[model samples]
Target: MTSTTVRPDLDLTHARWQSGTQGMGDVEIAFIEGYIAMRNGGTPEVPAVIFTPGEWNAFVLGARDGRFDLT
Candidate 1:
């Protein structure tokens, strides 16, 4: 079975990052080594925030549920 666990030494040097559909210079995300890596397109030199699949799912659900809505 495919593992969803990210390796401690995960390498993202060759990650093919994809930007949001809105346009360029937005947040970029890369799925690599069983982890999700996110970084700002405007500042790629900065370290990315890594998330596990479960964490990503939770964040997505929260967004869809408007848990982060300002209202």
Candidate 2:
């Protein structure tokens, strides 16, 4: 599993969370301030995963290349 350490000093309340579906499911993914947050179905809470600009770039590239595919 990919792990990230959330900064306690970051105030996410004002953060603009852009939500979208990850392929097909009730699960939701949110992006804000270089952080990606996921909320599963039937859940009310979501933890934000912090990522650096470089890491985010790599993730995007990998995702585009289907490196995260699960079949």
Candidate 3:
């Protein structure tokens, strides 16, 4: 949920994807044109979800604040 507009014209063909140190099942992320692209590491064939800088920050903040905790 961001107030900024997303850049759909950005190309991710050469994007170098990164993942956490948790080994096999971790998700992948790529930084491209000031936006964050996320995708499943286990299934790279699936298209990625793009997020604006503000949306990425908000997601990180929410994760750090335990808003995503299921317990």
Candidate 4:
């Protein structure tokens, strides 16, 4: 996992974030620089995961293709 600084001036509380599964209302995704930052709901101060551009692209493609779907 990679770590990056989220802009303090930005407010992510109301930002929209989606995870692989439902029922997680507090999850949010933010693209910062060359990485994708995922923050848990109500915890904007911390990031759950920071994916690199390549990793982010792979995840996007996988999700699009339903590769992450539970079998």
Query: Which candidate leads the pack in lDDT?
Result: 3
> TM-scores of all models?
0.76, 0.57, 0.79, 0.50
Q: Which of 2 and 4 is the better model by lDDT?
A: 4
lDDT per residue for candidate 3 within 1-71, as digits (tens), equals: 76667468768789999998867666999999888999997887888989988899999999999999899
Q: What is the lDDT of residue 19 in candidate 3?
A: 92
Please give, for residues 1-71, the per-residue lDDT of candidate 1 as tens digits.
88675446667789999988879556899999888888998889888888888888998899899999897
What are the lDDT figures for the candidates, one per model? Answer: 0.85, 0.60, 0.87, 0.67
Better model by TM-score, 2 or 4? 2
Give a tens-digit lDDT track for model 2, residues 11-33. Answer: 55655554453556555545665
The lDDT of model 1 is 0.85
Clashing pairs in 4: 26-41
The true-versus-predicted C-alpha distance at residue 14 of model 3, in Å, is 1.1
Put down candidate 4 lDDT per residue, 14-36, tens digits, no spaces. 55566646764666677655556
For TM-score, the strongest prediction is 3
Model 4 CA deviation exceeding 4 Å by range: 1-26, 42-46
Comparing 1 with 4 on lDDT, the higher-scoring candidate is 1
